[model samples]
Target: MSAAGPRADVIDEHVAALSAALHGPARAKSRLIGEIRDGLMDTAAAHAADGVPRQRAARLAVREFGTVDDLVPSCQRELTIAQARHTARTVALTSPFLVACWYLAGSIDQGQAWQLPRTAQLVAVHLAGVATFAALFAAVALAATGTLARRLPTPRGLPLVVAWAGTTASGAMAGAALALVTAAALATDWPLLVCAGALAAASHAAVAASARACRHCARLPVT
Candidate 1:
């Protein structure tokens, strides 16, 4: 009708306001905007059918979507949880690589190809590896298997627990690595120990970074 042009302009303004209020990955923001536009159009169409003027209908539709202040926090919470979930998945995928790196570094330092002694130190290191694997797996499973979606859609349990476990495991892994490197350095030359320690340190750093990111996302203010 004659109001089509003004209706489009109104929709553009609403979309712009909504877009400016959102913050997250570009893909997610785009998808959200698409949904919002669809909703706005539907609302405007409904209002038009009810004999509302086109411009007034568009404004009403925008109002129905809520103010920027009211919607921003909701969008932020969703985006933050999404970021945390993504980081958790990345940590899960990298966990095996990290474990292998730690094992390689530790074995090289111990100067033995396959010597896993029953000593207390060996037991502790093994336990730390097991704990790290378990924690990362739990996080990945929750995110991937739809369990998190069904039960605790907005809860912080999944990401927070994973971050805490990852941090604790990192500390334990670092201690074990230091002990192994020290023992090797005392028994052998420094070159091999240094190389192995560097590799272990790099791997641990990656896991730490992932966990820290997840923790930050989890703590994002929903207010």
Candidate 2:
């Protein structure tokens, strides 16, 4: 009997053990087994292409007998946890910069003497709140995308597309926010203008930092 012949029995034993371990979830176990079988088949095909006899390659693949139902789920959970942690870190890192930008914009408005009409001042505050919320949301989305770009299984081109799109959008938003602040400066009294300008500068700095972080994250090889 060939070495390959002996391997089939070893694989069968392992599969039996896996089935026993997964006794309570037959359907899930079956699915996991199917995935393992497919992976093994792919490996066997590769081996055959590299000159192993078809029968020997099939036998060799039998070594990958056990389903990883429990293991796979645990790995998935861990991945989810890690992703959450990464997102939290990204947000924490970016928030201060955003706040600083807002403050700078406010300072610029103050410098410009932009005394708003009482109604307009209320409107401006409301708008600033909305803008801050939007900035936070955008930052979170960009950071999440950066995380996905690191983890998702995809063609090389897909990640590049996502990363570039995110970077471009971020840059554009930053530019627009700056323009709005500058316009506010021109239109308002000197104090308000100074505050707005300061806020714009802060925002620009935050966005610049975020863009750099995203680029760095994108360049990292997926683990």
Q: Which candidate has the highest lDDT of all?
A: 1
For all candidates, what are the clash counts?
A: 0, 39
Compare the candidates by TM-score and give the number of the best one: 1
Alpha-carbon shift of residue 130 in model 1 (angstroms): 8.3
Candidate 1 regions with alpha-carbon error over 4 angstroms: 1-5, 49-51, 106-145, 152-154, 157-216
User: Per-residue lDDT for 1-223 in model 1, tens only?
Assistant: 4777777788888788868766554666788778888988889989999999888888899889887777777776676656555555655554554455446544534544434321323643574476467555656645643565776554546556766656665555465556446645553444544554455456467667766765765565565
Residue 67 error, candidate 2, Å: 2.8
In candidate 2 the C-alpha lDDT for residue 207 amounts to 44
Candidate 1's displacement at residue 160, Å, is: 4.1
How do the predictions measure up, each by TM-score?
0.61, 0.32
- Model 2 residue runs over 4 Å out of place are 1-70, 109-223
Q: Give model 2's TM-score versus the native structure.
A: 0.32
All candidates' lDDT scores? Answer: 0.62, 0.46
